[model samples]
Target chain A: MSFSSTDTYIVSNALQLAVDAAVALEKPLLLKGEPGTGKTRLAQELARSMDTELLHWSIKSTTKAQQGLYEYDAVSRLRDSQLGSDKVHDIANYIKPGKLWQAFTAKQRPVLLIDEVDKADIEFPNDLLHELDQMAFHVYETGETVTAQQRPIVIITSNNEKALPDAFLRRCFFHFIEFPDEQTLRQIIEVHYPNIQQQLVTEALDLFVQIRELPRLKKKPSTSELLDWLKLLLLDPPKPGQLREWMSDEQRQSLYGALLKHEEDFPQLRYLRQG
Target chain B: MFIGLLQLLKRYGVAVSITELLDLLAAVNKGLAGYSIESFYYLARTILVKDEGLFDRFDQAFYAYLQALDEVDISERIPNEWLSDPLVRQLGQLDEEVLKQYESLEQLLEQFKQRLEEQQERHQGGSKWIGTGGTSPFGAYGYHPGGIRLGQASNRQFSASKVLDKRQFADLDRDAPLQQRGFQVALRKLRAFARSGAATELDLDATIKATGKQGGLLDLQWRPERHNATNVLILFDVGGSMDSYIEQVEQLFSAASDEFKNLQTFYFHNCVYEAVWPSAARRGEVAIPTGDLVQRFGSDYKLIFVGDATMGPYEILYPGGSVEHWNEEPGAEWLNRLTHHFSKAVWLNPQPQQRWRYYPSINIIQELMQERMFPLTLNGIEQAIEKL
Candidate 1:
């Protein structure tokens, strides 16, 4: 069971090996990288390629580890009991299943994506360590151990917001996804915009890579930003000129909104040559 | 089991444990790496090394182990009987890096002793003697990280172990270019969450009690959402010696803005004399007096001071010792005043922690801050946050 690049998503050689090892070892693959290296998109592509379910649990600052397992709606149950509703009798009705539960009981082995794991509290990963290792969690209310019928492939992404706990890191097969190079970037562009002219992509990518390499950029434009910039470029394409001369002020500076995310970087545009 | 490789990794301070080695063995048993050493290398890396920061060390260790195996000469080989023992094979290699470490250490200590004998007063520049910003391999601010750095006790026993233990990766990465991401991550630990925002979340416990008291009638309750209520007051020492740390201080400034909602920053020179300005642009203008600042921010705010803290002892002790203007009170008085108001206060010194004791001004301020001065690194920030 090897993961290959899909029509939409591209997997580098290193990432492929990491995913394979994690899947084989039955360990969660902890992915870390810059914001837009497509760490979240890997799980989506993997599920699509495998013809399986993709269970995405998007984490937030307020998110708790308990929410991933299950949430008991005691307030709803109490309200139903007050109204004398028949739903109050069954406690299981109020025990709403979370992303983990759904993944656990799925007929087919799913790809469970715990996106932005670092956004939550520091103790979040530590709380889920046992469940992740055992592939089971005990429901105190239901008095039942919810064990995974088929262990799903888990992929967790972190924006490097906080340093993860060591014990949690020890259990994971870690892989850092670096920004794709020119060759890979070109391939990514081709896959996304099949009808786009090759010359235009080559020219745009050359300028993009140069812009990225410039020092003191607060936020380097990633692949997603490039795609957006390209999309905007496609609608009203820049006029054809010499390789360096083609990208004049009117063509580049006017589209600064799509490329340069920060106001400080607008001044950095002056450092770039027309070529 | 690659016991030799594991030992080599540990010797290089990679911190590879038995559990990680077992994980590597498990991967090998599952035929993850068939016949290719490259596959095995990747497999071992993915299993053993847990951080990207240690990648450079592991890369060197892994190659060194492989080279040791290949470079085993028949002439230098140990007896056939002892060769079978992994520990014997590992020790028999006699790594060149180990020899180089020992050689450099001896050379460093010998030179350091000679320099100490020649030096008299505190030296700053020039290549010779124990000083700063020179090609000298004996003291602080020298480009060499592996040099023997003697703090105040140059006559104390010069340990070769301390000199050999210095690996340049961590220091190099932090010193090459300052990143705000590291500061932001460190500052995140100083969180004090309080329910301060609008009442968006449902107060379930209160609702249930309210409903029960109302004769089984349903009554809903609402409460404010939790927000980070950590108020931070940062005083940055600008100009002179602090110019070297401007990049780091500025990065911290930006990161602080991103992390805290109630952050107040002020600029001071050398030390906080009587008043601190609001910004570095208009430094001559005093925005707020140091006395009023104590009452304005209150004790609830966590006070942070960013500076190199390298100045004359008189500047902190005497009233007329300020470089810019004559003052009624010394800078030490202002620091005491601030710390008295804000119980949770910490001074972040950009100067390396090892060199802190050499500066008398730093010692005076440290005593004034009650030993709350911390180095402005990730580990230092974590410790500071814990104290706060």
Candidate 2:
């Protein structure tokens, strides 16, 4: 319990509290954040921490709540019926149990990651209200009610693409993952690159922050991008003596693509550097 | 104590359901929350608050409840009074110096720490002390190249390297009775409906036809709901000249945020520049580039410019014209880019149309806007929305 590689999840006080609240209340933890802020990663970390099986359900725009509950393969059933197969007689044979059904029937409580719940329409969350509330859903084709043997530790994430209904929101404990500060970011870097040079990390963080603060940057470099940039910097490590002076504009510009995703920001970045 | 807190929240129209209350009590009983006010606050909020929209109302109620017990506390922040004395802040002849002594952030923090120890009392309008209206590497309302702002409200120069205070949203008057019905009506006209999103609603006619084709076999069909698909990119001109119309602008902000489904608001000063802030608190901290807005949002988005459009003619025409920052490009170029990118755009000038002729800058903006500039009056907004 004291030591494990699975505990690589750097539990900030805020994150710990959020996890604690969600676990204690047995409610779905709704995590909202900007892209690459570790919303999906948090679910995996939670599962690893709890020593539970992780069940990921990546949501697409076309994803529906009904698909999560159950999908009736009527075409297969109709074809089988036309073929005069014995399997067609039983509707349960054609009933495909969805991720929710699998989670409900799991032997132990599993961590269900409903990744990018906002990618789906506004009604997506609303449609799952009954199943989420009761931890159960009905299979109309088979006339069977699928109830949870052990309620899954549900972690739903959203990028706030669209406004979720008020009713759907009330069911879960919400947590907004703000961009990590310098201290937390350092720990995060340490988690990824354990034996990285301190001066390099400091200088990289400094320049990274400066670029983020540049007025009217189209896309600020995210946590993942910072980590990715750090990896690139670590490859060709700068001299310890030259750490005081930031990388030259030309040198920086070569690696600038990682920091600034948008081409429009390149000109602004130059302006910031000069002024 | 918990019940009293719940009651207070209810009184503030937070709509905390009975089940949520019971769940909160259950959590307390289970020893989930530590014997701390903050832990209790988080736990209660997590249980009670259902929607993000109610977060403001919940925060207000929580503060009011805490205030009753004389335990109201602001988040831990660098002392504001230690930095500035706002009363004595002289507008004229403000010291403008670029403090680049600290080469790096670590060095800056070290200097700040040393200064924090040496200074015993508050000082204002000084070059040395971490006070306002000075060239110190700390505090706001001062000119410091890459300084950490202690408090002093929103950033003016966009030079504060970092802000220490926990950012808070401006308390919107949501409960205030809608005094302007015409304004709301005008905003409603901006709605453009489309069935573009994921299929969420049952297409009854399609389902029926599918069922008939399948010879009595139940077939289901889903079609996306018809929603207000109009994308609105609203750029609000804040600070200088626009200060008088804060109340009016706020009303418009509130109405637009409520009415439009896909509304994106950005703040600029006087005219469109290279960048715009998402909020006033984050003005200096981060700026989303105007180019990014053009790239992010398509030409379909109705670009609505909310500003007085009244500034020096040089401000719009000449580069480095902006009083705050030395904008590399002229304001007119950016406005032209915005108009070109967005086929549907209108400038909502808070200034009266009659007074527009007096201001040369307004006339310049009108020409760039293709004479699509309208007054902030109800009728003017109606005409603008109709044109959109």
Candidate 3:
């Protein structure tokens, strides 16, 4: 069969190939893209299609590799020990299994998503090298090695916040979700809003394309933003030339807030309007 | 077949492990990757190719390996001579009948499609064939209302909607232009201090002092927060008008790399479009969204924009002014966003201060920077550092 799996995410041929390759290799698929490019949604869709449980690990600035493996509740254990509780006798009772640990211990192969891995410190990816490579980690406190029942399909996403270490990069397959081309964007919009008027979609798309090409806007409207704008447009449809001529300057500038995310971008809409 | 392909990829500098190779084979056997050549290529690349940076090298290897194994060469996939330039033969004048027939864009496109199939040999300055510098419906540097350009270096005319080029940012020479000592002297002015962060290391002094006050009792103390570390965000403009300043800019970049511990560098061409790349070669394939970048780097980052600030006024004032891509927001909007986020910011221009008045874009940038623009000279560097 062709690589394009029947999914609502509308995976392009290139993306489909990348997915197939990652699946075939049993390596983690490393996705790098701008915000609102559907990196996280792709993982969710892939898991749904493959009939696997989704195990998500949303990384934060303070997120550490040890937290992904297993968190030792030493403070809780100490409190329990002082209280003379039965749970205080065993360290394993207080061990909270992390996302990776849970994925590894699952009976079936799970889709483990490490979302926004770049949010963590530079050393975060490197820290996961051992466990990701070996597919097992020793619970030193419990003296038990937690090994994978089946190799879980891993999907890692990044917003390109930080450059991942070369050592960490070498273990995974990489794919970049580029800004969707016109045709792809059209298809995406259609998928999300099936019954929307064709004229509105066309106008909004054209206006979006024009706004994105504005020379001075800091934050260009992304795919998600485009969808949101389209939803807004559907509420009160603009006249045929309303985007260019009909709407008042204030109204036009206020409406531009949907497409241009930055505060600095609002003033620049006047220049774009002149064009 | 898979092993041979892997060997070929290895020869071409695409590192693939034995386990990855095995996985590719397994994928093919299980029908996860289809039987088509296209599917196989993608499968092999996804499994074997680890780094996104090595994608161009992988493509070259894949094309070479495919050509060697099969008698048929897929020239379309590879960057060959056909994609380089139009054949140099000249058919100076436009044929009246041909001109009439190709009056509309649709007619010209139709003829261009026919020419793509019929014309195998390279030709230039011809009305009928797909060649350069002619009234032809196809190829670059030709006079056409709407033509299909196969391969061209720079888009002088805004006629062609499609473009194909294999140039990458990493291929550019990154050697320092200035003397090592000179660079060091210029870079010393940058002040860096680690202040706030999650406490990891133990503060022995604090721990000991606290223990003495507690009558010899044990007191564990974490390291002082270093979260408010001095961070520097460098936006280095490459290509187009900035070509002359490459050497000096490279020196500054080298100096900054050596001097700053918290340096975050990104590469842009002409202007910071919607996104920027770490390397030139990977620019087309990989880019960090400019918006995400603003959100990622905090307000404390010292933003140093390095560029000539010399370009067509359209590039700054109008949409679709960028030479490389049709950027939605003008370059000025992005620059302003960056400046707003980074209170401490400066634009270092390599073009001598004397030439500043000549370029309108320079004036526009200066105004945008609120007169923070400075030259790349030693004196200029000192002034810029002082401001920072």
Q: Residue B30 deviation, candidate 3, in Å?
A: 3.5
Candidate 3: list runs displaced more than 4 Å. Answer: A1-7, A246-249, A267-275, B2-19, B51-53, B68-128, B131-223, B226-388
**lDDT per residue (tens digit) for residues A121-153 in model 1:** 888999999999989999999899999998999
User: Model 1: residues >4 Å from true position, as ranges?
Assistant: A195-198, A239-247, B69-178, B352-360
Error of 3 at B142 (Å): 17
Q: What is the C-alpha lDDT of each candidate?
A: 0.77, 0.75, 0.72
Shift of residue B347 alpha carbon in model 3, Å: 15
Question: Top DockQ: which candidate number?
Answer: 3
lDDT comparing candidate 3 with the true structure: 0.72
RMSD of 3: 14.9
lDDT of residue B153 for candidate 3? 46
In terms of docking quality, model 3 is acceptable
**Ranking under DockQ, best-scoring first?**
3, 2, 1
Please give, for residues A1-275, the per-residue lDDT of candidate 3 as tens digits: 23353535677666887877677567889997667888999889888887779999999977999999998865566457556789878888999999999999998888999999977777799999999998999999989999999889899998764557777877887787767766678889888888877776776677677778786454678898888877877677777655555334556556667777888776766655442
**What are the RMSDs of all candidates, in order?**
11.9, 13.8, 14.9
